[model samples]
Target: MIDLDKVAHDYGGGALLSDITLRLEPGSFHFLTGPSGAGKTTFLKLCYAELVPTAGTVRLFGRDLREMRRDDVANTRRRIGVVHQDCQFLDHLTIAENVALPLAVSDRDPGAQADNLSELLDWVGLSAQARARPPELSGGERQRAALARAVMMDPEIVLADEPTGNVDWEMSLRLLQLLVELNRMGKSIVIATHDLNLIRAAKAQIAARVLRIKDRHLQLAGADL
Candidate 1:
């Protein structure tokens, strides 16, 4: 669904990522691991067209990102869901409303799909907390809610950045299982995380390829991982 060829990105400094080529095929699962400031987040941004690469080409679906218009980029992004490190939500909005924000902003009526929203909350074990505000939720609850929101549109691909960063081990496992379920349902999944233990744990439950960033390049993680 995402294709990059010799992709390189820079932000006024030297290149953050360079000579990276990757193809994220449909229904494939991948774990992206690297130390801090290793451009894992920047790589994810390129996948979804949030940032245009300084060099080379990034293709979303079949079209080159640089060739897509603003509306085209926006429409294309609807097919890709992103779970940011910070689960930013409007505190005034209820959990259900927050989760349905994607539909709302896309000119779709959230109330029209109320049943699906309910089921999604239930799937994330947030049915009872649907009426609560963001601040009222615990770390795990917030993360789960973020997951629910990310998949609100049934996106074809899900990119999660440090999804378990703020949660406990038990909660991290819970989130991993939820992501695994998404993968089973045929969603392409890329989780950018630094937690090796979490990657090891996921390897036992799913056929996932681990990719590591080193010296501005992407490489397949060795069996030692």
Candidate 2:
């Protein structure tokens, strides 16, 4: 669903990613692994249109990234769910409202999203705290809320960056379960994390392929660990 051709990205004229070419097929699962400062975030932003490549073409669905206007990029984002390590939320909004914001931002009425929101909250084990504000919820709850918000749009692709960073092991597994369920339902999943244990845990439940980023390069990681 995503195609990158000879993509090279620079920050302040310094290269972050070079000669990056890859294609992500529908319903596939991938994990991006790399050390700190290895350009994983840059790569993810390119995938989600948060940043345009400095020297190559990025095609989403079928259109070239350069051809997409800002509104087009915003619209394209609706089809791709993103869960970040730092789950941004309105401090005053309740968990339910935070999860529903994606629909609100898209101006898509979110018909029956209330019901879907409840279901997702329950799936993520956050139903009991639905009315709580972001600051009141634990780190894990906030992260799950972010996942709920991302998928609330019924996106075709789910991209998570360090999604399990701040949570305990139990909470991490719970969050992973939701992602696994989405993958089972045909959402293409790509997560960037440095946690090998979480990767191994996911491997036990789904056939997820691990891709490591090293020296500004991407390669398939060996499951031999």
The candidate scoring highest on lDDT is 1
For model 2, residues 1-225, the per-residue Cα lDDT tens digits are: 899899988898688788888898899998898998888888999999999999889999898999999999999999999997888788888999999888888776678566888888887778999999999988988998999988988999999999999999988888888899999999999999998998999999899989887777777898463
lDDT, each prediction: 0.94, 0.89
What TM-score does each of the candidates earn? 0.97, 0.95
For candidate 1, write residues 52-94 as lDDT tens digits.
9999999999999999999999889889989888887889999
Model 1 is weakest, by summed lDDT over 10 consecutive residues, at 107-116
Stretches of candidate 1 exceeding 4 Å from the true structure? 109-112
Runs of candidate 2 with Cα error greater than 4 angstroms are: none
